[model samples]
Target: MTASALTFDEVRQARVALVGPPNSGKTTLFNTLTGGRQKTANYPGVTVERKSGRLRTPVGRSIELLDLPGSYSLRARSPDEAITRDVVLGRQEWEALPDAMVCVTDATNLGQHLRLFLELRQLGRPLILVLNMMDLAQKRGYQISIEALSRSLGIPVVTTVAMHKNGVQDLLDQIDTLLNQASVTGDGTVTTDAWVEPTPEAIRGYHQEAERLLREAVIEEGVPEQLTRKLDQVLLHPVAGPLILLGILFLMFQAVFSWAEAPMDWIDGGIASLQQWLAAHMQDGLLKSLLVDGIIAGVGGVVIFLPQILILFLFILLLEDFGYMARAAFLMDRLMSAVGLNGRAFIPLLSSFACAIPGIMAARTIAHPLDRLVTILIAPLMTCSARLPVYVLLISAFIPATTVWGGIGLQGLVMFGLYATGIIGALVVAGVLRLTVLRGGRQPLLMELPSYKWPNPANVLLGLLERARIFMRRIGTVILSVLVILWFLSTFPAPPQGATEPDIYYSFAGMIGRGLEPLLAPVGFNWQIAIALVPGLAAREVAVAALGTVYSLSGSEDAVTESLAATLAHDWTLATALALLAWYVFAPQCLATLAAVRRETNSWRWPAFMFIYLMILAYIAAFITYRVALALGGG
Candidate 1:
């Protein structure tokens, strides 16, 4: 048999699965092999993340690499682990049995990692074991007999650093060789049996076998590593650790405001120039109004905040890569336990800070159903990147740009306060829910902390690039369509002849806003603000763009050159601005978030409850903020 004799499916594209435990550096290797050419979404009927990429081998063969979610065992517990177990055993409807598997394991924790490896070998796939972070293992004085490990496991073993480009060539070569073997011989190299659920006795037997193998293959040469211990003395102190976590979070939010200033100015200037050119060149028609006010002003208003978003993502990726995120989760465990939840809930809530969808998806990692439900319910309370534009816009307009506390910017401090408010709100909601609707026994936090290392620059860049693409994609589709529809509403039913007010005052949007004005007015929102809230239900950031489009069209002709921030500051009272900010802090601003909640819970009951509670919270918070501001003579 030869390579030329294989079928097209086997010859052209071979499906390979990358399986490993959490914090095992499996994703790092996937990124190395695929060069960030991966698509990340959810699998059918569940929110477990599906990540896959394509790679071309040296022999002109293409490989489809599936990066399975990190799991501890073949015995399914969480949805993430279930996905891994199902795909490998050919149980999933959408996935084929992988022709080959790359089982990555942390070199420093061979005892626990080998247990998973031994269980996976039962599938009898053409598997290759990758000992990632070999350099880190060597530095820690841990040694392993690679040849003996391979012999014991009856498979090929390779070592990879994963962060560097040259690290994965050996692993790739092994995959190519196994794939080639499958293509030519079509031997019993793949699992063909239906997955049988494991019994306790069988699981215990596998663990024993793993322990036996580890003793033979691994050699512990010295005392345990002291770097993490030395760092944790200060980092994990009861007083200092919490203080340090707060300081780190505060600094991260502050950097979102400070570091993004120059780039934001550049984007603002570019959008302004484009708007001016379009206004002057187009012949003052619907096209001109639509382009200048609807598209440019609407999309540009949100796009300008990309710098701030990227900065936030940069910090998150760096913290995650440097392994401090796990420590942060650990620090929050005690606080979480006090709230009647466990430390496992901390990560999902923390992840919710970036986006509720992922945060809700991340709840799948929690073992207990009640705990997962509570985490999902409170996830939206954490301010996501979408709310950054709303916060930055309101703060820049109302909060002075002056330095406070001897050096910090007042705007940044305000931004940090907004984030803290969200955190406090999430805790309160979780505490309430745990005591009421979802009360249950708390699970213990058991997680292995990865060794700290300098974040790989290439990985950071790729992470940022992926986030940028997501933002741009939203701007081009959902935002674009919403803006166009909003433009129509603000333009049509042509203003009554010789109307004294701006043209928008008589448009459909104005009528709709006025209809809701009485309801929202107590919170300091006028007709325009009310109108903006309608589009905001689609996405939180859209409210900023909606305001831009509404104000751009409503203002006098000279207002075209002014930024939205300046325009808002001139027209809106400080009381109204503060009210809006407070409202957003608890508001259910994204329908996508609600949809995610619905999918995660598999019911409309939870989503409806989520929306009602959040709305009540938003209204109360906004009313209080508005009343307090007025008392302080903010008007």
Candidate 2:
């Protein structure tokens, strides 16, 4: 079992942890090392994500690389930081201590970052210091004496531009060397007294030592942060920043429609061709009905929007990598403070745009209980990607595709409006909650603004690919399952002989929709829409599939051949389409989101309250929209 004598398989079992301060390029390093060989899950009994990957070294030995949550110190303040602390100290339940540590730091901000490195050194583990963003450091004219740094830090040091393919080879070789040595040296025993929470004086001492180390081992050649400051002058301006942010968002929505149109059309055509081939080749029976009406129609309707969803994620990933996300939080702090929320809550809320589940979980980063609760309550209103399918369907069916303001497509304009409505709703709800049940003064937003960098193509592509995989998986699993059940419900208990109405009229789903239609009538929802809403509780996108399935089962042969959008355009009024759109903007329809709220809050009461209030809002919004649109001759 000796380190030097161990085989490659034993080396493969070695676990190394990557730790760093927030925005220190640690994640970029992890991604570069691991590529697609990664798995994400939650640690035992905690909501913080556990990200680990298998990394094969240049020497052909593999090791498990754990990407721990970012932390500034071992004295953890938030749940995320606590996980990092526990894992590093071998206190996390069901998780083995890492064999070695890789402390990644922003090369340009080594003074502040080195403080954490000093603390990790006290743990008495085999540690390597990775100065990531070395390319950026070099551009800014930083001169670091690596030999002196390693001598002073008493550890091996390496520089990396983690976004590049070749940037991490040296770090990998260094890791292999460290693990090889640690195996022979015996387990690096951690001192029990090493991790006592440093007092204010001790903290100041650490800061002083870090500064001294920097002065002796590092030198700056040119004006530091010159480019960052120049860019921030415009991007961080009080007036221009918010305006620019809005313009970027507006453009993103515009691209979601304009850029993805061709791909969406291709997908639509492919689905139509598949349906046609099935109809022409297969014998007409229960199995044909299930395949054509249930699976293809349901899943295909949602799958067509994949291009648009990917476009949306592309914009988000690019902005995030460019470091404007923190600046966005900074810009929104004024308005966030006005609503009695810490600006830090903006990150979680922004994440909600992708999905409310992670958005709610992201709230664990907020320190104040009341603030975090309010954030969790309103996150679902942030217009997640789940709602995109429904929105696109209704908009394409009811709204004219003509251009407005000369070049902007009316559809994209309306899409932007829907996103704006969700944001406004979330802010209003947050304000009300803070004024009432969750009353509390807002905490000041104290966060780092890393220097902006070019978006890494590899990182962006990986993110987009991951999102696409998740969306497709959902279609294959949840949406497919729901569609089959819906098909059975809408097809079973065959219609009476010589029945005049469609066969689904006598089915169970029809009965259920009819039962709920009376209550939904005021909001302009028909029986078909009512049926869709029931399964939509499982996922917002499933509503799209539900509609496709319901319509395919209940419509004529000609209607079944038409796209869901065309069929809806022929049957529904503009008022109903607008009302449904309004409903989705407010409805807490996704059960996964509510479950996330419960888990994050550790109680059912908040989730119950969230559900009630959101349902009320959806109803009222739909009612008002229906009435107003009807008055405007959209009925």
**Residues 1-635, model 1: lDDT tens digits:** 45565567656678999999988888788898998678877788887778899997766578899999898888777778889999988888788888888899988877778778878888777889999988888887888889998998889999999888888888877887888776667756445475576688887887799788878888774346688788888888989999999899879867977898899788878888888787778898898988987788777766876787788778878988988888888888887877777677776776577667667877898877787888898899888877977887788777998998899998988877887898888889889998888866776677767767788888799888877876677678767887788788879878787887666668887888779899999999988899888778777877876676567543422243237778889999999999999999999988767877888888899999999999999999999999999999998
Q: What is the C-alpha lDDT of each candidate?
A: 0.82, 0.84
Summarize candidate 2's per-residue lDDT along 218-317 as a digit string, tens digits.
8664348877788999999888988999898779767876898899778877877888899999999999989987788667767776787788778878
Lowest summed lDDT window (length 10), candidate 2: 553-562
- Model 2, residue 24: C-alpha shift (Å): 2.3
> Which residue pairs overlap in candidate 2's backbone?
none
Measured by TM-score, how close is model 2 to the native structure? 0.87
- How much lDDT does candidate 1 score? 0.82
